[model samples]
Target: MSATVGSALAWWARTQPEQTAIVVDGESLDYQGYEAWSSRVAVHLRDAGIVPGDRVGLLAENSLPWSAMALGIIKAGAVLVPLNSRFKPAELRKVADDAGLARVIASDAVVAVAREAAGMGAPYEVTAFADVVGLRDAEPDPATDAFRVDREPTDPIAVLFTSGSTGRSKGVVLTNQSLLSIVFEASLTEEGFRQGSTSLLVLPLAFTPGLVWGVLMTTVLGGTIVIEKDLVPGRAVRLMEEHRVQAVFGVPLIFDAFSRTPEFAEADLSSLRTAIVGGAAVPVPLLEAYAAKGVTLRQIYGMTEAGGVATATLRHEAKDHPATCGYGSIFTELKIVDADGQEVGPDEEGEILIKGPGVTPGYWGDPETTAEVITADGWLRSGDIGRKDADGRIAFADRLKDLIITGGINVSPIEIERVLMGLDGVAEVSVIPAKDEKFGETPAAIITPSSPDLTAADVVAHCEQQLSDYKVPRYVVLREDPLPRLPSGKIAKPQIKQDYADVHVDFDKVR
Candidate 1:
């Protein structure tokens, strides 16, 4: 068998038939069981007229079936489009139309939302997740090899939509070769990403970090993945102890929340060997919090364009340069460049560029936008400002895109400002990131209202109806004076950011 994703699962089933592959909410699925389950789903999809190169939409919370369904789509040689569960109807409709989905598999919890979203887009078939996963008696005939399609290494396996800084979502097309390359390389270099290791996965599978690092990489290593739909702090600690989880991948907020749990003091975290934090800068207190529990919190840095992980701080190097994102991964190369596209010397702040096999080819159906970010020679403009030390370690400085990462989810300030600008009472609005001790950063709206009666409360209420829960402004500021502007007639965000540099949100009252 080839080194494609579907082949890896088949290989594992044949090699370790009874080995546990996944544990979801106390339910376990062995290698053979998972392979058979996914194969069955592929058969059903082929029966429903799905073929190679077709795009399939998966809308569901994290669950055992969701994992199987993801692999099943790959087995059937179709592209999997994982939709965010937090998306409202309009958002979903946009994604549905953009991906030109042929069929959508939705869980019972979000089936109604899927219907409403699909109703607004081009007509497509919607199947309940239960109906597809429950095809135990409808096995495919062995003569046709269960209708499994063979995929080449370069065949697109999944199209992940990353929320752009410009408020438009871009679908990044990822190939089987790209995903498998990262999986194999990281297994050798990334500590705790080893065979038989158990990892606690709390991030939603829809996101890049969760799907790539938590699922694909773990599966390729024949490791066990413990999926948690929601992050109940106490339950997460208990689950880690119960599963003897060796690896935990999440953002700073997750570790911060875990430290505050009552079980933190007496929790048996002895099993934890690799705890990696990303999505935001890891606070020193958060690293010390995990350190006290006998776990080291290593930092990782990457984006959806880099296939989830481009650089990671290894165990041996974590203590020396605790703040850096460490050296590039096995197959990744990193460089910092100035505005003139010239490589800067060590310790110089510039835009980070990545070149590697795991790097995305380009955005789906948007060649012009793709050319803007990725150079012709294959280097990707990360849009993140950072500096590389003499030792080749990368330290994050700031974002050129001005994206706000709240609770591990990327929020575009432009997206929120567009929504707020729709309000009749709002004349001009500028959204900036508010410092939060709990969530790292949250959206804060600073507005110069047209009407004197336009209050912060009204702004929040208007946003509640348009944006997702995490995208809503946690801190609102109403100013009587006009916001500072630049010569180009754009909002002077740098000046505004400096003005509110000390502004912090009380998460207890807002959340």
Candidate 2:
């Protein structure tokens, strides 16, 4: 057994076979159970001719099967490409084609969607692993006898999709050692990630926090993870209470939804000792609310290329600097750099550059784009705006990409602007982030109409032709003035964003 997840699982199964490894919808699978199930899946993959280094697709909603299927893919020594369950045919096709998947293992819940996506010209095969959890009954001679392919640490394990600044999804190639490095670091940390801890994960298992931090990190520590397929506010609260979850992870929106629930005040959340929140800045009120319950909700700032965690609010600074992402982790080195790439002094805002063991090697199959983001000397240009305080704590300023993260998903405004500009009467269009009660923030399009008659309906209709639904602006404002520009000739997004703050458009009234 090597220093991989598969080896870790084997160690755990041998040491504590009866320990509860995963729980979903009231059913629990012990370490031995999931190990045996994943073994059978590995054997099934081998029988189907999936060789080492081949990329296999794992498409399913968060569930016990998803966990097993992912482990099986790893054990088979094949690369895993975890597709987002919410993707439509076009997005699915894009990922499948990009990954050049050897096969896709979709659970029964989304087997039909997978089949439809496969038929839409994704070469290779799609296996409908009916009753994925029932794979344990495949009746292998013994769990110990299951075949395990030794994988090199340098071998690529997963290609997680990220919405790049260029609009298309960039498959971040993470090596086995890259992931293990972070997981191994978490195991030794005193940040509430410990053995026998029960973690509740509500976010999607496709990327960052969900897979690397939530599932993989938890498994490495031999902890039990509670997985919920979809996050219905009430159900999520009850699920956490029912499981007596020790640690919880999600974005700020997840916490906001829980706070909105009437039961939040009295939800018996005493079991929640450590609350990890990320994605967006934590509102002071939200932090106070959790603090009142004796739960210190720490904020983390990271990206897909940083192995899911870069800087996290240290335990001592958790309550004081509730807004800042925090000091850099021992495994990652963080710095603020000026436009010319020189290191900036304290409290000076500049691009955040990170370099460490957690930083990814590069993006999959695209050396040109990878070279642009990752410097030749091994530093990753985060494309995010931030600054460091005198105390060495990192605080987020803004995004260099001008990205709108609505509902915790990145929406490229440039993609939408291109579509809106394509329509008649649209001279110039700038998409800015607007505050939303549900999603925290959504896209708002400010247009300078060129033609005599240009309707908001026309703009939205044109956007519908190209962009995804979430990327479409919920509010459209037609302006007679030119869009503000900086001295550098770039669109002054801060001004547009500030002006749009007070003006809220009702989406329901929009045509």
Candidate 3:
């Protein structure tokens, strides 16, 4: 019953040595070999002077070595801090300073950036990931008992940085118990996500969903994971067909890209039973398209603080309540509350509060901010507005900070966004608040159109038919390029709001 991740890996290695543990770029690692390889890496880390509780930074792209080194760091009793590979040196230095990493291991592709970041942050040694793997291979493995470090269920396992789509990123601390709880919940709730199942991982491993479910927990479940570095839709389709991937967890854009690929039409996706999409709302058309291909695209909802997923639409509800994020997850308790902390009735919009073993203890080294979010007795304030239907399904409204208060009327941007997304030619839509002289703040839709001729007038005409007068976007900005996205693939709403803060729509010319 030990919740430590290392124990899980060891158990799998003993029980199913020949099982395929991970596949990256067509190369596979069996569970037995994976165990020994991770053990060697852990022995090397200890020899290199890494101690228990030390925060070790990992900066690398998605690869087999990156995955092995992560388990190695955790097995060595160190706190793993996975850094974003896309971060600039300045951004890297900022997180390096915050985490106060004792050492950083970078892959060959990013050694230079990691070195520069180390130089700028608090003094910490930097080592190449390739070097660690090489050294471990050349040296003989230490006794299995030699690297054993007693770890408690509450001991910190990793520090994951939030995507910061709305603001500055914070390091969310997760313990072994927290992650294990989620793994248990997911295995029980996600149909077809079980032992021996093959999963396709396209999201960056640094993201919570990718690391928690795709890598760490998948290993615990004795499942095989196909890793894709660059998200080529055709390539992803091929991998799924080849590996018979059953559980696919990705954002909406990823699935959308797969649907556009020619390979997707003929690909044998019958093996795909748990196609879960989170990070953003799953378009109904996209869901229907996947269903036509004999795949049910379920919408999942959760945050870093909740581990990975707190709720996900079940297969039975996917057709009728595609908009809902489904009921609370197995181990998670969800409740809707008003601004004054009073519980809201069903069908009432309020902040969603989650309490569960999967929820994080607190943010790393930021008790003040942690106190502001997590209540004393337990519940974590989700900072998301939603409504629970009488059927117990939760419908996401919008981020509390993204709500538009136009003419003193609270408007949910997600409502407008869901409407805009339904229009033909609109690929992605983010509804933000645009300053208006008459209404104070009007809803503005920033659209990334798939069709070349998609115009603002067309968007307006489409919204007018579906939305109420105030709910209709007053301004529409069409961008030729894709909208800015976080690592989790969610639109950067704060950035969009900041970028268009000065945008104005003539009230006299408005509807």
- Best prediction by TM-score: 3
Quote each prediction's TM-score.
0.79, 0.79, 0.96
* Cα displacement (Å) at residue 152, model 2: 0.5
Poorly placed runs, candidate 3 (over 4 Å): 139-146, 505-511
Per-residue alpha-carbon lDDT of candidate 1 for residues 1-511, written as tens digits (9 for 90 to 100)? 3878778787787899899888888888888777777888887789999999899988998888888888888888899999887677788888888888998889999988888888886877888987976754354445333335778888789999974433457999889889987777777775577877889988888878767877787778888999887888899999899889999887665787899999887899999978988765666666778788888889988888998778888777776676799878777999999999999999987999999989998888889989999999999999888899998899876577688998888787767886887787876778899888789899988889989898777888889999898999988888889887532123667778878776673322243
lDDT of 2 by residue, 165-275 (tens): 333468898877898788766656545677778888877776676788777777777889988777788888887788888888776667878877877777888888678
Winner of 1 and 2 under lDDT: 1
Show where candidate 2 strays beyond 4 Å: 131-133, 143-145, 163-166, 403-511
Q: What lDDT score is found at residue 219 in candidate 1?
A: 77
- Against the reference, the lDDT scores of all candidates come to 0.81, 0.79, 0.85
lDDT of 3 at 371: 100
Candidate 2 accuracy as TM-score = 0.79
Question: Model 2 Cα displacement at 104 (Å)?
Answer: 0.5
Minimum summed lDDT over a 10-residue window in model 1 is located at 502-511
Count steric clashes of candidate 3: 0
Ordered from best to worst lDDT, the candidate numbers read: 3, 1, 2
Q: Is candidate 2 or candidate 3 better by lDDT?
A: 3
RMSD of candidates 1 onward, in order: 10.7, 10.6, 2.0
